[model samples]
Target: MRNANVMTASSEGALCSATRRIMLISPMPNRVRNLLAALTDHCFDVFSLHEWDDGMLDSLKPQLVIYDALPIASQPDAYNRWREQELQKASSRMNIPLLLLMPEEERQSLENKASVHVMRWPSEPEAALLEIKRIAERAQDVYDSRRAGESIVFKDLTIDPGKMIVTRGPEQIGLTKTEYDLLLHFITSDGSVQTREALLDIVWGQQFYAGSNVVDVHIKSLRKKLQDNAVSPRYIATVRGAGYRLADQ
Candidate 1:
């Protein structure tokens, strides 16, 4: 696999704080270059991948994936089928939304699916970028509105609130009710420090009085279950005199 070509909006001025991360997957070198050029002015961190790799996908943790499917669509039926099967498997394993670009003639072969947006290939760069922006915005909106009912994904961890289950990668890590609530609060804190007193009020309820060390004890247990190191945390981070916050990615 070719090394991913990264494009940032830093050339314009300061990087946009809300810049979205996009992974462009295409076997065609020219197409990848063209798309990267088109996105240069946008507030997006584009990672152009010449070939699809789930390992890279996990590592990148992009907000959206743009799969240029024209090459595969033009292949022999058997070859196309195999490639499509692999794509489906990779997509199924992640919560990131997909934007598929295919020829108009080949579009009919594909089915409509949730979180998968389709657009015709050979589109003008302007139109393609607009559609990509729209899909990314829509996906974010859906995630925000349905957060309580849907799975919350952060890096490699996934929390299914509906099921009250948390998984790191493919392995499920069991957590008690308090531990689960504490972790959920941390994820939703949006990197802000959560004071121990505030955490007690939110997770343990205002009426439940506890010693100063109660939050620390549960946090230690939660960190252990998440396999996070307090010294070098992947999920939670200490703030010295301040409370805790979700570690920066």
Candidate 2:
């Protein structure tokens, strides 16, 4: 456990012979931590971190990495910069799955490189775990379907699903998994107005929070990445209080 506050949460079930190791690089709320404890028996070993280190990557060799990208507010610029650099190194150097939970305000400020997945914080533990499982499955699919070379063309944007890459004209747009999936849903729906609830169900696979503006934040992020104007948009269109659409027509 080192310096982390560790907990073993599990129900009445025999422990699995093999367990997937998870290195959590953030502070979880007590309620969420309690929920995560249920997963310990389900073949999951979670370890939270109060600090960052490169040696952990070598020693832990975790199957997945979940990190917090929240602002310290008090930390000096140099300290924050160094931590970010180290985080990047950990992601790039290790070919494992990396999930980042950050404040919506900090999303644009952080680099989207290194194939790191992003999700908003203050999420339900079960929902977060479910999302992580989905990502793991998708990663496996990518590995197995490496030779398929599958891609989808939506207007000027070309999405390579297998590689999780999006290219518009000549430049490649770096998008987190959620952003890419949301865009894919919009494009495939052919500009149909998608309700916020529906978007949450489809993209997140679960509605973790009701009346949360998480959807809007992600949509805003997608628009920014696609260079689509919010007002008189070329691609994504906000349907006032209704929802959002791809603006196909």
Candidate 3:
């Protein structure tokens, strides 16, 4: 029997021989428990809870989340409130990939936030595990790629793709991993006004809704770093409703 208590919060920092620390976020305790077993079979450290807890969350930073987006019609508004809070900070602290459980319509409606990956529940546990592992693996790949982009420089701004480090003139800009990837995408595109569709295709590959304000949100952060101005835009350039471009001047 595999001992579930031996796993850490992180999936061995990058890649583990185990399935890594996977948090199953479902309102139902039974579902959480069952999924925990599935994760266990894959050698993962699993955490389960009816609602988000500050202290527990503060300690274990999960690498991946299996978010069962079951409707909260009767589950109380508290669960909904709790989810909003957790989802808000999740992308910031850890770029954990989420598997949302909801109706196809609900999943389509959530087509806005790029922070979470929404998927209707799968029929087979094996297939579900496959999807879970695939997302987690891709997340690791993204993290690895950003490391090399850490030292990338764009005129006034200097970004170390390897370390997720960014420096603008004298001040530094702290960017999330997604933010960093978006910036790098513009840089590597050869000053092209990469459409949101292209950005979605290139950056996320096939994770979630790539066309969401995720691009806008990340660009907003990038603009702040480049000193939001009209003089020379510096790093990222606005192609106006089309997409964004990396400016030379």
Model 2 per-residue lDDT tens digits across residues 1-249? 344433344455554665567777754334245434654645577766655666876787766777766656676576568656755565334545677776666654443332356776666667777877766655544443444766767678887877889998889999999998888766654243566766776677653665548899999999999999988888898877667777755
| Candidate 3 per-residue lDDT over residues 15-73, each given as its tens digit | 44545676665656555455566666667778776555545555776667667656567
For each candidate, the alpha-carbon lDDT, in order, equals 0.73, 0.66, 0.61
lDDT of 2: 0.66
> Lowest summed lDDT over 10 consecutive residues: which window, candidate 2?
107-116
For model 1, give the 10-residue run with minimal summed lDDT: 108-117
Off by over 4 Å in 1: 10-15, 72-75, 111-115, 142-249
Best of the two (2, 3) by TM-score: 3
Candidate 1, residues 36-104, lDDT tens digits: the string is 777756777788887788888889888788888775546667657765765555443445667778788
| Span of ten consecutive residues with least summed lDDT in model 3 | 1-10
